[model samples]
Structure formats: C-alpha cells, structure tokens
Target: MDSTQELIAQGMKQSVPWVRTAGIEFTEISDGRVVATLPDVAEQRNHVGGPHAAVMFGLGETATGAVVLAAFSDVLDRAVPLVVSAEVRFTKLALGPLRAEAVLGRPAEEVLAELDAGTRPEFPVHVTISNAEGVTTGELTVRWTLRPNR
Candidate 1:
C-alpha cells in the first residue's frame, strides 16, 4: 500500500546496476518493511533448479534497501544511505518464484536522532527469504548506514 515503491525501485535500478539485470520485482513496501520477489526464470535458477543463492541475496539486499528508503524518506536530501555489511544464511533449498521480506531492526526516530546530532547512524535490516508456499529458505541481516552529506 506504500506509494513510494516506484520511486525506490527506480532509484535502486539506477544506483545498483545489477538490479536491472537481476529481474527483481518490488511487490510491497511500507514504513519499515518490504517484500520483494524473484521470477522463476532460468537465469535466476541454480543447478538444482532453485533460486540461486546470489539471487536470493540480491532479493534480501533489495528488500532491505526498500525499507531503508521508506523509513528515511524524510531525510533523503541530507544523507547518503549505504549498506555497510551483510550476513546471510541459506537454511533450505529455495524454490523458484521466491519472496523476500525485510524489516528494519531499529527505530527510525532513534536513528534519525543520532544523525541529527551529526553522528552517522547504523542499523540492521533483517530479511527472510521464502518460497511460494511460505516456507523460509534463508535469513539475512544487512547493516545499513545513513551518512551525513558534507
């Protein structure tokens, strides 16, 4: 129900060139949560006929980025957002047409307060990748930061 999906997707496509070629679709986005999916095409599949691990990682990254953008929509022009790190675990064999859900792990207002105080703030975004049937396949935690623009 979030209207910023289009703008975030466009910005992602331009900023992360791989997104354009990755075939990721932004399905839903909200204040601090987002859902994205990968098509069941050959390019996104692995040797076992499942979604490739890297593709799944991409989904996690993209979905987390969407939530970051949505949560910090009010401070866009004053900062530069970046993913500082990511730790992902592939727990199961993922199927095609996979979906990834990402949620911000910290409060937006808290992070904003730190940024407002001239301190670059970092937060975690947790992502869960699942199959069409709602079975989770992987979990990823991406640490993101909003750096104050000089």
Candidate 2:
C-alpha cells in the first residue's frame, strides 16, 4: 500500500475500531478527495439481504473524515480535524459492494492556510455512496473543524 493508504489503514487499525468491522477499506486518498469501499458481506446485510443504511453512513463518514485528516496530516503536531456534524440521506437500497467518494469543497492549500493562521475552520465534505451497478444509494454532508488539538 502507498503512504496515504498506509496511514489510513494505520488510523483505522489503531483508533477506529468500528470501521474495520464495517469493511471500510481506503481506496484513494489525496489532498482534497478520499475514496473507500464497503464490501457486501452477509454480516452487514439487512433482513432484505441488502446493504444496511448504517453501513453506507458509516463508510461515508469514514471516507470524508479520512480526506479531511489527510488534508491536515502535515500539521498534526499543531492541529487536528474533528467532525462537528454530519447529515446523511439514504436515497435507495445499496446493493453489492459499495464505494464512497468524499470531496472537499475547498482546496488543501486553503485549508492548510487556515490552520497555519491558528484559526479553526470548518468545511463541508460531500460524500456519494454507490453500489457495484454505479447507482448512487446515499449521500452525506459532513462538517469538519480543523482546530488546535487540546
């Protein structure tokens, strides 16, 4: 795995215990975007044999949080990202393996600048969760804050 993926995996392994059970695997991580996958597993299925809504929401949050953290990874010694609120919508039943892509509205440079200036900035990350058939099954808007780690 690459450095970004390794860092994501390490974070999940060390702190986010629930993400592992949900099968949230980091696929891509960049300055302003992150992608993850939630495998279609029997353990995660609902009574109707489809992926549960919670799985998508959890993966969405995880994906968005990963991107925000990756965007601020360089300043870990001074600041950290925290999810203040999350709004999620379940559009349809997510079937098959699900993939979630989270995009940051602001570029990484702008975000880092805010942190460098010792300002707590909040940004919204939009996440779209799709199934193997490429149908959007859910959406998440996560508001994260970059603040000094106190």
Off by over 4 Å in 1: none
Which lDDT tens digits does candidate 2 get at residues 81-128? 789999999888877899999999777788778777878888899999
Candidate 2 runs further than 4 Å off: none
lDDT top scorer: 1
lDDT of 1 by residue, 1-150 (tens): 444678887777888788778878887888888888888878678899998888889889999988998899889899989999999999999876889999999999999999999999999999999999999999999999999999
Error of 2 at 47 (Å): 3.4
TM-score of 2: 0.90
lDDT, each prediction: 0.89, 0.84
Look at candidate 2 and give me any clashing residue pairs: none
User: Per-prediction TM-score, please?
Assistant: 0.93, 0.90
Clashes in model 1: which pairs?
A: none
